[model samples]
Target: MNRDGAAPTMKGGQFNTDPIAAPNEAATAALSQAEFELFAELGRPRAVEAGQVLFRRGELGTTMFIVASGAIDLDFGDDLVTKRLGPREFFGELGLLIGDHARSADAIVAGAGLLIELRHEEFQRLVDRNPGLVCHFLRRAIMRVVLNEQGLIRRLRRRNQDLEAALDSLYATTHQLNQTEELIRTDELTGLYNRRGLTLRLQESRAIGMPASLGLVLVDCDRFKQVNDDHGHLAGDRVLQAVASILRSVAGPEDVACRLGGDEFCLLVASSNAGDVMRFAEFIVATAQNLMLMPQSPPAMCPVSVGACMVDPRADWNDWYARADEALYQAKRKGGNRVHWQDAALEPV
Candidate 1:
């Protein structure tokens, strides 16, 4: 679109004399007064017919033309994508200023046109004499380069902001996933490891072949259902929590305790000997017996039966657990508050 008031002139025999039709005329006239006089002496107005080709792509040229009226279409490619220029717009100056280089784009008449042709040799001589005109063109080129730089900076800033947002979202999602994993592998009532967690750790222990011996201790709160019925489920939960605290206090750092279900719990002690397992079971029984006399109502006494067995790597986890469970039954049979140990060879004793 022609924002300025310049218009193209017809190509045929029509000629224009108006000076306002040329872009930057006032500046050019002031800078090239002597050359303007020379142009008036040597050159004449030229006319171009409608639909005529002004310049073809790749055509070697040494002159530039300024539109005096009408419009010309610029074609950069075969798809015919064209940009229309009108009214004082100039073209062919780039090739003219640079040597006999071929035109990069085709220029054709959109309508009948009038133009003022300036020979490159004369224009160069004029610019050499008038430094002001050369400075003005140079200033314009620098301004265009600065504007392009600003546009690129804006795009880069937007991309950086988007990347930061994406990273923040990913971090939040990972934190939530960790919390979910903890909940899934923990016992809600006793705050101890669940079966799944114990199994996983056991596999890792076996894989490493660390300490030679591992032991499982099975524990059952005596008459736990009676406690729940007499004192309500809340009191039973408090009792479980207290018992878990005591176990944690006694267990070694390498040991793990798991709540199997309801009132049953299990402990896995790494690298513990048969004597250590026996002593730990005895400690559990004595601790629970002492808690029985604490001034809590409803549940008659806090007491437990414990059974332990050394793990056999040659056997499956279930088989190891079953032996410990049978030993616990034997302890309960003997009395509700006692400790029992299973033979490492797992004979039916």
Candidate 2:
């Protein structure tokens, strides 16, 4: 753990300094200047800038380094800064001493700094000539190995559990967000897309390239007020729900079926063929007439009037809606149960 050369003093009965080991001298005199220079025999000077890659994870390494100044960081290619080595600290000790060792992580320069790289061959020469130094380093390396195997695994396991919990929380939050969005865009009464949803779709449509043809249908329930007046408001709600179901059944997946508030509903569809819009509108009119209402009110109760428009290529949502609304009134004027088609151009009629 003291790879940073941060030991306050060196001690142990096996190793002792002679005259300099005087009673007055402190026991913690770590690597005296002269003694430290011994590593020069193995040193090859290196300098690095911040963020520079010194070595990569899982690479085979035959060298170790001593940080003379600045700092080096070990990473597993994540934002987590795994280990940091300060001045005089050493890393790659395992790979250098253990023949054919592969790096467990990446090394990067954390700041501008210098280092002394010692290859395995130089270490062998040093150990051969200076047999006494072997015991001390070997003891340290063995102790480090024991600590890593035992401590590192326990630490990493706890970290993994913490990560799993964090991921679960993230998933839950995302699902809640989706549910909230669904509620915001849907009409509470009929479960159809609301006016807010339609506005958003319109804005998105405007941003795209012009379609071959877009169709809009405006539907109105005939004498809806009479139902509320003759029967209770509950009966009126049931009538609206029935209308919504009929529109839902008639619409395709790509079509937008919306309750535009009150007794009015709208459908927007896209088709490659210009004639498809008129045909779709006709089908909707026929289907609306046949819709069965509950508790059986008079035939006048749920009749519908439909106005449809094949939107012009150059027109926007406002223009299309106006034309469709005009057609809807024309249908109501002629008779309650009918479909009126808006032309490419809205004449003064």
- The best candidate by TM-score is 2
Looking at model 2, how many pairs of residues clash? 1
lDDT of 1 by residue, 187-249 (tens): 877778888877777788679774666888898998888889888988888878877876787
Off by over 4 Å in 2: 1-92, 99-119, 122-140, 149-163, 272-276, 292-301, 343-349
RMSD of 1: 10.3
lDDT of each: 0.69, 0.72
Candidate 2 structure quality by residue, lDDT tens digits, 186-294? 8988999999988887777668865667788899988889888888788899888878887798788778899999999998887655467677777767776666433
TM-score of each: 0.60, 0.65
